[model samples]
Target: MIHKLLTREQIEKGYIRFLEKNPLALMKVNNRSQQIEIILGKKLSNIQYIETANILVEYAETIGIDSFEYLLLYAVESVEERQKIILLRDELTKHDYSVNKYTGNA
Candidate 1:
């Protein structure tokens, strides 16, 4: 079974990186040139993740039910976490966590 330990973002990034490094394998599995572009997320396409699934099977050390689903979920989760961090950082920069300026009472 693929480790559920990995968060969504890690899987997504790893999967994308895998594609970048292994273009020939991608082309062979996709069966068409048009589909490959879609997988890269360069063009609006739904089949990108699906195509990645094939690579997973070939490269994955192990596989089980809903492997692709899990990977996708982790990827999305990772992205959400990053967005939250950005927003939080912005808020932190705007204000300091300190005692009220007017209230002299500590």
Candidate 2:
């Protein structure tokens, strides 16, 4: 878990550094390449204002839930989006152990 809260700039910088070391992670997500370009401040493609919602979702599911809250607070700008992330993070943390699956309607 991340102990200290990171500012937006710090979070972006860290993400960029991470991508530099693990470039394949970014290459795998080809659909929204513009978002990555916007964050990097390069004039690769002119796209709408980008947000971290997709990245947050992907990371939270594939990485670790412990860092979800921190990532949401640092990367997400919309209050509504942050609220959704918080709720999802809480649910995942609460159910971190159980692996029950639904068989059918009962």
Candidate 3:
């Protein structure tokens, strides 16, 4: 589930927590945010942007950095698209070894 709407200060605090955990993820997060801006042709609302950032950070923590970048790219799409990508991601992660077994030999 997505988070409650966050104030600017709350968002900043959340980012600080993310930074404390993964310093290298900052650049990737910034790049993803910029891509979102380009796709939308304008900046996101504070709440939208903050929620996106939080989602990315949380996913990065669970999924590892490489896969998280791919996830962030999906996040640039519409909400329905993001949800679809997330469901696919969850399924893939659940059957990660099985996926690799098929793809690795192909």
Highest TM-score scorer: 1
Instruction: Kindly list the per-residue Cα lDDT of model 2 for residues 11-105, writing each as its tens digit.
Output: 67545544444455455444466655757775543321133334545666676574556455445667786787567656765555343333332
TM-score against truth, every candidate: 0.37, 0.35, 0.36
TM match of model 2 to true structure: 0.35
Best by lDDT: 3
Quote the positional error of residue 84 for candidate 3 in Å. Answer: 34
Q: How many backbone clashes does candidate 2 have?
A: 0
Per-residue lDDT of candidate 3, residues 1-32 (tens digit): 12222234544554555545555666556666
Relative to the true structure, how large is the alpha-carbon lDDT of every model? Answer: 0.53, 0.51, 0.54
lDDT score of residue 66 within candidate 1: 47
Q: What lDDT is obtained when candidate 3 is compared to the true structure?
A: 0.54
As a whole number from 0 to 100, the lDDT of residue 103 in candidate 2 is 33
Q: How do the candidates rank by TM-score, highest first? A: 1, 3, 2
Model 1, 1-106: lDDT tens per residue? Answer: 2333345556667567666667875675456435566556455234555567665555553546344443444344466764564456456544433343335532
- Poorest 10 consecutive residues of model 1 by lDDT? 93-102
